[model samples]
Every structure is written in C-alpha cells, then in structure tokens.
Target: MAGAVQWIAESVQEILQISGLTVQTFLVLCSTFFLACVVFNRSRNLPPYPAGRVPVLGHLLALGRAPQLKLTAWRRQYGDVFTVRMGMKDVVVLNDYTAVKDALVDRSELFASRSPFYYLFDAIFGFGKDIFSASWGPEFRQRKKFATTVLKNLGMRVGRGSIEDNIREEANCLRNRIAENNGQPFDVAHDVAVAVANIICSMTFGKRYDYEDETFRELTKAIATISIELGAGHITAVFPLLRFVPVVNRPIIKALEASSKVKNVMREEISRHRENPRDFLDFCLLELEQQEKVAGLTEENVMYMAQDLFLGGTDTTANTLTWSLLYMTLNPDVQNKVHEELDAVVGKSLPTLSHRSQLPYVNACLMA
Candidate 1:
C-alpha cells in the first residue's frame, strides 16, 4: 500500500503541477482510480492463471529460450488454455494451433484489440497507430488494406515481380559483399542484416543504405536495444512512475532518440516522394491523396506506417536470416544437404523463386 502510494505520488505531483489541482483533490481521485481497478479486476472472471507466480515479476523469470516450449510443457499439466502473469498483467497463453485458430480466426473480434500500454507506447509512438500494432478497428483495417494494395502492386503477390527483382539484385549485392570479405572472419551477421534491410529499404524509400552506413547501424541497433530494454523495463508499462528512476529511464530515452532519427528519414522520403512518387511511399502518398479526396489519412498516419515498415520489417527478417545462416554453419549434414540441393537444381545458373520447388530440401531449410 505504501509502495503504491509512493509510485502514484510521482504521477500525482506531475498532474498537480500540470493541472493546478489541490493535494486533497488529487488524493481522492487517486484513491478512486485504484479502487475501481481493483474492483474491475476482481469482477472479471478471467482465464485460469497458473499458480507458483512470483511476487511482482510474476512468471516472467520462468519463460525460457523458446516460450512455445515452456507453454507446451505447461499445457500437459494445465490443459491448452491457461494464463501466466507477466508483471501485473495476466497473459492467457494458447498452447496449440487449434486454440490459436479459434481465438484469432473463429473469434477474432473478441481478441482483436490490443492492450494500450500507456507508458510504453503512449510515451514513444502515440498509442494504437502503427500498421501491425495499431488498434484493430476501422483505421487499422483501412491502413492494412492500403499497405496490401501498395505491396501487391509492387509485386508482393506473384505477378509483375518487381519485389523479386529487388531481391535478386540485393542477393547479388550480398554475394559481392561476402566475396569482398575474402573468406576471412568477416561478419556474416552484418552482411545478412544489411541485405535483408536493403530489400525493405528499396520498397519503402526507393533506395538502400550502404552496409557501412552509420545511420543504418544506429537505426538497427536502436530497434534491437528497444526490444531488449522493453523486456527489461516492462515494469514501466504497468507502473509508469518507474520512469522517474534513471536506470529504467535511460534506455527509453535512447530508444526514443534513435526512433526519432528513423522517423526523420521517413518524413524526408515522404517529402521527396511528393514531387515524383516512385517507391512504396509514392504508392502510399498516391493512395492517401485518393483517400483524402474521399476522407481520412493524416501525415502523422503515413509517418508511423512507414516507420512500421522500416522498423518491423528489417529487424525480424534480418534476425531470421542471421539465425538461418548461423544454424546452417553449425550443422554440417544439413549444410551439405542444402549444398547438394543447390548444386543439383540451381547448377551454375542464378537461383530464383522458380527453383523453390525443385530444391525442396533447401527450400525447407531456408523456410524452417
């Protein structure tokens, strides 16, 4: 109770300073707010939360390398549906594909909305506005529709093949970058990251950064740091007052500064696209113009949309490619099989999407 008051006191002081509220009035409002939260939590008949939860951290420390593996083990004991508390939040983990399909496909609307972490999201990007992470409603639906349409036209779907062309070109660039390494202890991770990031970059801004680009390095580093720091600083999500502590606050500030650089680049790309639209940004601007004629779509909306593509697209793809390369290097037998498949199907010719089926083993390895 005292600890809760201490945390709330920080926020209360800010509110008092901002709104000129008396201490008495602030205390009453704070009491009522917490009381309501307690009432609401007790009233809702939530899923079965697993026992053996730690004090404030909950089961967070128990999560292992593969969270799925942990959940699968738990499923045997607790059945397919159960919740685990992370911080103060109860996250219901669905163990099997059936449960996932039921929740996401069969009853999507009930589970579609995202929890708005006021400290985490609202402090950085505005709450519920980006492409994938946005609130699942009309705005998100329209944004997704717009993104897919732009992507489809740019050959994301198997037709005109502009995206594939970009991939092939980037693949060649990656190959040359590797060749430049001269089989020494060159950073495969660095090369693969730039290669993957370049593909998304080409689509988003009609240009790719050099592998040695300082800004690109900072951007990727920031994205990674944000992910790590968020997991570490998750308490801030539940209790925003944690930001008053320097250790917890520093990472958030660094992430925000890094994000600002990425956002600025996106805004610049948007500005450049205004005259002669060419890339995905061009397509988006064109779509936005049409949408504006009809209604809805702000510049801020476009900035977040582009940022989503740049940040989300690059980090995940790069991580996958890096892991794939790492695993292939680690396992000789799998690597040899992949080599044999490539030798048999691809030969001296360049590899393309067309060779996917013929090199089934290699395809499976890459996909896996």
Candidate 2:
C-alpha cells in the first residue's frame, strides 16, 4: 500500500512538472509575441493605437453595431490619424477631408491598390478580377481606361436612345409606381432600388425589366443579400481565419451563394449578348476578343466588370435617393424650399442636366 501511494505521488509530481513547464513556455511565447508587436510598431512609427485591444480579436468587439460612431469618437481622441488593430492586422485610419484628399487625390497612385485583406469582397469580385477589388497594376489601369471611356461615351450621348432617355423612362416608371399607391403610406425603398437597378439594367443589357419581373427581383434580392452578408461577415473579413469555422462562416457562405446567383444571371446575359451583341456586355465582349491576351480581358474579367458596375451603380444611388426622400420628409422647411426652387426653375417640365447650373439651391441640396 505504501509503494502504491509512492508510485501515485511520483506520477502526480511528473504531471505537475509537465504542467508547470507548459505554462512557462506559453508565457514566454506570449511575451515574445507582444514584444515583437511593440518593436514592429516602433520601427514603423505607427500612429496611436487605441487602448483595450485584446489579443487576436483586437478592437473588433469594441466596434459594436455602428462602427462609424466609434471611429468618430476615436478620431476626436486620437487625432485625424491613428493605428487601429483589426484582428491580426494593423490599419491606419484617415479621418477628416483634407487628409483623405491628400492620400486619395494627391497621392492617388500610391493608394490605388485595394487591400487583399477584404476577403469577402475578394470572393465576391472573383479574386480581384473586378475593378473594385483589383490591385493597382497594368491590367487594372487598362480596365479602368476602357470602363471610363465606355461610361463617358454612354453618359455624353443624349436624346432618344441615350442613357438620359433610360433615366427619364425609369423616372416616369417610378412616378407611376408612386401614383399607384393612391396617397396611402407605402415603403419607397424597394421601388427606388428597382428604379435604380433598372437604369443599370438598361445601360448594361440594353433592356429593362418591369418592377415585378421575377428575374429582376431575384437579382436585386441577391445584391441586397450580398450587401447584408458583407456586413454580417465583417468579422471574418478582419480575421479571415474565422472563415474556416462552420458556424462563424454562415454569412460568408450566404454571400458566396448570393454572388453565385448573380454571376449565373450575368453569365446568362453575357451568353445572350454574345449572339445579339448589344450594350455594355457586347462592348466588353468585343474588347475581350481583341485584347484577351494583351490586357487580361477574359470572359471572366468581363463578367466581373459587369458585376462591379451593377453593384456600384444600383445600391449607392438607391440609398442616396432614399435618404434624400427621408431628409425631405423630416425637414419640411428644406423640402418646401426645394419644392419652390424646382417649381420656379423646372416649372412643370422635365428637368434636364442643362438646368443644373440654373438651380443653385437644388444643386446645393443635392450636394448636401
């Protein structure tokens, strides 16, 4: 019995020694990591990092629902520039207009590259083939030039079969849609989105869909899903390693599925455009045929380019219009002034781009 007890005690002592060594090793590793971080920050001369940054997660948990508000608060505390640790990456935040302009406008070429850290957008944009997520390089510059030229041509052309005509038609459709509500309370967000999306559809596909069209509805839903999932999966964007976790990656999966749906629709449209040769897709296809090898203008690139245009054009414009309507609703005085300006300047006629300079107040309101 004494020998048994001694054996058990020896075993327990061995286990305790092992545990002590393991803990000491872990502490050393942690200290080394933190020391490396400090050294790296000092070497880079990084801006002020916020307090309360936990290991691994960094400031993510503190960001809460409205990260902008938190960032604004941080800006006040840490000046216009600060280093924010997001997950495992250190990000430099630029606040205020002048700083942003200095970086984006003055040193535009230096900051033209998109961060490969945006894993969600990278996936949606097909691994940087799309303009929005593409790295700043020869291929991106060529694509940008092509897109700018095409858009400029489309925007400049006026009268019957032009982009202006498409916008006017969509505006009329929106007006009719509102009129159908019969002065009753109705949500205008979806209708506004549909109108904006239709304008893009017309520009891209040389076709427009009825507001209730099933395919169009599906496309918009997918886009909306992607937007929502992007927000939901922001954590994964910062900590891309989390994407491997089953439960945590639900949003990423949904985004991928939504992106697939949108891409499938775009692919179908591209196939149709191949035979008929119409609108932006045809323009892209023609370019692809000529410069496939030279400029990295592949079918994949064209499809992604269309996706970028569709996403960029639709959501932003719809959100802006919706917010303007909401602002007008909230501020009756401002709305009245805008109404007076429109009535005086536009005077029951369809307002054209030519009248923009004439209606300064309206332009100010729109700019605001």
Candidate 3:
C-alpha cells in the first residue's frame, strides 16, 4: 500500500514538474471538465438549477447527504420545474404535481427519453438494457408493448380475476399469517413486503412463494439492499467512472448476485413457457415467437423485463402498504371508519370488485 501511494505521489510530482502545474491548478482543470460540459451543452431555455455547483461534483456538496430532501427544498426555492448538474449530466426535476403531470403525462413523448444510468446500474449491476432503463426507442416500445399485452392478458386491467383479485388473495394470505401469531404485536413490514412481492410473483412467475420460502426471502433481501444502495444518491450516479472503484462498487455486489439468481429463475420459467406457456412468461414468449426478432424480444430482453416487473411491482407497493399501516396505527379514527365500513358493506363476504363501489370510504382509505 505504501509503495503504491509512493508511486502515485512520484507520478504526480513528475506530471507537476513537466506541466509546471500546481496541485490547485491540476485539481481545477480536472473539475473544469464537467463544468465545461454543463455550460456548453445546456440551452438558455433550460430549467433553473440550484447554485453553488462545483466542477466534477456538481451540486453534490450543496445538496448535502440527503439529496431528496435537499432537492425538495431546492424545488421550493426554484419553483416547479428546475434542473441540476450532477457531474456533466443535466437533470430536470419536476417538483410540483402540475409540472410533473405536464411533463410526464401531458407532453410525455417530448420528455420520454431515458438517460442511461452510467455509473453502477448500467455498467456493473447489468440493467442498462432493461425495459425500465432503456432509452425511448423501438427497443423500449416493443418490449413495453409485449409486457403490457402479457399483463393485460393475465387480467391486470379491468373486470373479474384482475390484478385487484391477485392483490386481494395475497391480502387474505397476509391476514391469515397474522392470525397465526395469536394477536401478538409483530412487525408487519417483512410480511407486507413478502405479500406484495408474491403478487408480482404470481403474475410473472405463474405462482406465489410461501413467505417462509428461502429463495423468495433472498430475492426480497437483495431488492431491499438495492433500493437502499441506489437511494444513497452516491457520487457514482453523477460520475459513472466512480462505480469501478472498490468502495463504491462493493455495496451493489449483493444486488447483482440477487439479480443473477432472479434471471436464472426467469430463464427456467422461460424454458417452461417455451414448452407449454403458463402465465406472463407464456404470454411474452408467444409474442416473441411472432416477431422472432433479436432486437425486440430476445432472451436478454425477457430476463430484463421480468426483473423490471419484479423490482417495480415489489418496492412501491410494499412501501405504500407499509406506510398505510403506520398511518392507521397513528390515526385510529380513520382506521375504525375503514373497518366499520368494511363490516357494514359486506359482512362475511370476501371483498371483490363489486364491493369496491359500495365501500367508498374503504376505497378512500386505501387511496389515502
């Protein structure tokens, strides 16, 4: 380690001597690379970004450790739509609901292009080509079309035996699991996460895993770890090169391993689907068979799409349900109202789509 450090120091000394560049000057030049990129490429009509941007690091210092909360503060100051320079990448954040709706929904096509995450997820974690991360183009369109068709075919849309049914079944399973605990106060977080994950599993993999299932637990753990690591808002996202560094890269190794396990399971299911197509996998395979095009529906695309569905479906729902439970505990009046309405609307009957209209309060509670 000392020798490596000495070598680096000597190399720096030689470069400084030859270029007649001081340490500060060299550092300044290194940072100016990102600043120059940001200044030259950005248009005048672009959204306002927060000030105090450093060269390579951009607004990272100003944003501090909790970038989300800091960005929320910046949003309040800068207005609904504002931009930020994360390294050389110019990110436009839609802070308010109106601006977000306008950008993402109203003029979606104009702003639909997905900038690749170069740092970790793209280079190392191996999801650069997935449906979620792929740039808006023919590839993304075809993959999305196929995936949507599968989802719709499996009753993800409207009417009976829909995604709601899938969720309701899992919710019942969750209730039963809780009942087994004999009314003892146990942490519902993990059970909720597993239940939510199982819904996605039933859709994608054709069946649900028991909450005690080892493989399911491992995958969820990996997904949770990935969420935490990615949520860190590390410099790696801004500076793609940093992902290669051991320290920055180590945290994601578990996520990648988990992804590998997930893809292997997907591949096995794809094989089964090829022989006798079952659920979403079968639907995807059927569509892929039609095109037979390598660009759109390759095995790689299938694996990535499956990963997207699994990750996308698991995290957000788990978070929302978990938060709802927390709020229910805090606000017992609302909780009681929800329960009372449920009892009065359909006593001794399993809730279904028809019950939804009769129980507006229940719907509102879930929505809230």
Candidate 4:
C-alpha cells in the first residue's frame, strides 16, 4: 500500500513538473514574440501607428465590415498618411488623391514592388511571374514594355477593326440581352460581366465567345468568383499561419480553384496561339521567343500575364458599368441629361470614340 501511494505521489510530481515547464516555455515564447515586435516597430521610421492595436492581431478586428469607412474616419484623425497594423505587418495607408498620385505616379519606381508575403498573390499569381504582383525589376520592366507595345498595337483608335469597334459590338449585344428582360426587374451583373470579359477575350485570344458558350460562362464565373473571394476578407490573409485552419482558409481555397480554372482556359488559348499567332497571347508568345533568354519570359510568365490582363480589365470595368447603371437608375435626372447628350452627339448612328468629345454631359455622368 505504501509503495502504491509513493508511486502515485511520484507520478503527480512528474506531471506537475511537465506542466510547469510547458507554461514557462509558452510564456518565454510569447514574451520573445512581443519583444521582437516592439524592437522591429521601433527600428523603422514608420508612420504613426493607429490606436487600439492589440498584440499579434493588431487592429484587424477593429477594421469591421466596412473597412473603407473605418479607413476614411481614420484618415480624418491621422491625416493622409498613417500606419495600421494588419496582423504581423505594418501597412501604410495613403488616403488622399495627392498622396496616391505622388506614390503611384511621381515616385512610382520606389513603390513599384508588391509585397511578396500576400498568400493570394503568391498562390494565384506565383508572385513574380505576373506584371501585377511582380517586384519592380528587369523582368517586370520587360513585361510592361511588351504589354504596352501590344496594347498600342491593339489600338483604341476610332475606326473599323479597332477596340472601339469591338466595344460597340459588345455594347449592342448587352443592349439586346437587356431587352430580353422586357423592362422587368432582373439582375444585369452577369450580362455586364460577360460583355466586359468578351472584350478582353477578343483582345487576348483573337476570338470572343458567344454569351451562351459553356467555356466562356465558366471563365467569367471564375473571374467573378476570384474578385469576390479577394474582397471577402479571409482571416488567412492577415494571419497566414492560420491557413492550416480549414474554415479560415476556405476563401483562399475558392480563389485557388478559380485561378486554376482561369489558367486552364489560358493554357488552351496559349496552345492555339502557338499554332496560329494572333492577338495578345500570340504577340506575347512571339516576344517570349525573342526575349526568353534575356528577360526570363517563360510560357508560364505569358500565361500569368494574360491572366493579369483578364482579371484586371474585366472586374474593374464590369463593376464600374454596374455602379454607373445603379446610380443612373437611382438618379433619373442625371440619366436624362446623359441620354440627352448621347442623343444629341451620337444621334441614330453607332456611337464611336470620335463622339466622346461631343458628349460632355454623358462624360460628366460617367465620371460622376
């Protein structure tokens, strides 16, 4: 009996010792992590750190649902430039037009490189392969130069076979699609997205898909999914370490799946372009052949570049058109003025880029 009791006592002491060691280790690690954060923050000549920054998470919870409103409010308090701790990183916010222009236009070279840490860019774009997420360097400059040249060749000039012609054709298709709704309440988001994406498809693949084409529908759907997932505010974006957690990483997974779908379509287009060189993909392939050795222009780079163009062009344009329509519906007076301008300037003819100068109220409404 005494032996059993002594054994039990020893076991209890051993368990307590192990528990004590574990707690001590945890405290040490936590202390070290915080101390590192403090030291690193102090080392940099960073902008003013906003208040309510807790350890590790650091203002993430404070961002709330409408981060833009919160940011605007913070801008009022902290001026155009202020720092917000987003999880482990210190993000500098530029609120006003002047600061934005200065950073993006004037001192563009200094601010050209994207952060390599973002999981979205890393996973979807492969970090440096694409122009959008690439670091500012020779590879980026080469891709940018090629893209600019290709865009110039694509020509937005007001004439037959120009981008304007393509826009007019797509616009007509969109009008017809809307007419099918018979003035009833129906969502035009998908139609608008399809219209905008088709323009990009025409530029990239030298062909546009029918609105009912299964592949085209899938492509647009994937692009839309990616756009929504990006803005869906995944916790993994802030705390990348939490990517192991399934619920936290669901958005990232969805984005990856969407990206894969887009890439597969791009691959098919690229293969076709290889056989018959035409449009953006063809142009890129030709450039890749000449500059592959010097500029690190791989097939992968070409694919990603095409992906960047599609994603960048489609989402922003579609969203703008959607928002403009929403505002026009909300403010019929402004819409009437725009319609008056369009009627006066464009008349019964197909409106072209040449008519832009004549449509002042229409331009104002669009800008508004």
Q: After superposition, how far is residue 155 of candidate 4 from its true place, in Å?
A: 1.9
lDDT (10s digit) by residue, model 2, range 1-368: 99999998788668768877565676787799986675344326878887757777778888778989999999989899888888777888999899899989999998889788878888999888888888888888888888877765666375544578678778988999999999999999889999998888877887888888888788888898888776664777777778889998888888889899999988999988865445788788888777743386788998999999898888788889999999999999999998898899989766787788889988999989
User: Candidate 1: misplaced stretches above 4 Å?
Assistant: 1-43, 48-85, 93-101, 121-125, 231-233, 292-295
**TM-score against native, each model:** 0.79, 0.79, 0.78, 0.81
Which model scores highest in TM-score?
Answer: 4
- Please report, as a residue range, the 10-residue window in candidate 1 with the lowest summed lDDT: 35-44
**Backbone clash count for every predicted candidate, in the order shown:** 0, 0, 0, 0
Model 2, C-alpha of 356: deviation from truth (Å): 2.0
Candidate 3 at residue 349, lDDT?
A: 57
lDDT computed for candidate 3: 0.77
Candidate 1: tens digits of C-alpha lDDT, residues 167-277: 888998888888886888767876787888888888788889898999888777777765565557456775566778998777668767777777778888888887566
Worst 10 residues of 3 by lDDT: 118-127
Model 2 spans with C-alpha error above 4 angstroms: 1-53, 59-82, 95-107, 156-162, 275-277, 292-294
Model 4: CA > 4 A from native? 1-43, 47-51, 61-82, 94-107, 157-161, 292-294
- 1-368, model 4: which lDDT tens digit per residue? 99999998788668768877565676787799887766355436878977778877788888878989899889888999999888877789998899999999999999989886668757888677888888998878878888877876886454655688788899999999999989899989988988998888888888887777887788888988899987776767777778778787777888899999999999998987875556889888887777753377889999999999899999889999999899999999988888888888888667877888888777777676
Candidate 4, residue 339: CA error in Å?
2.8
Give the Cα lDDT of each candidate.
0.76, 0.83, 0.77, 0.83
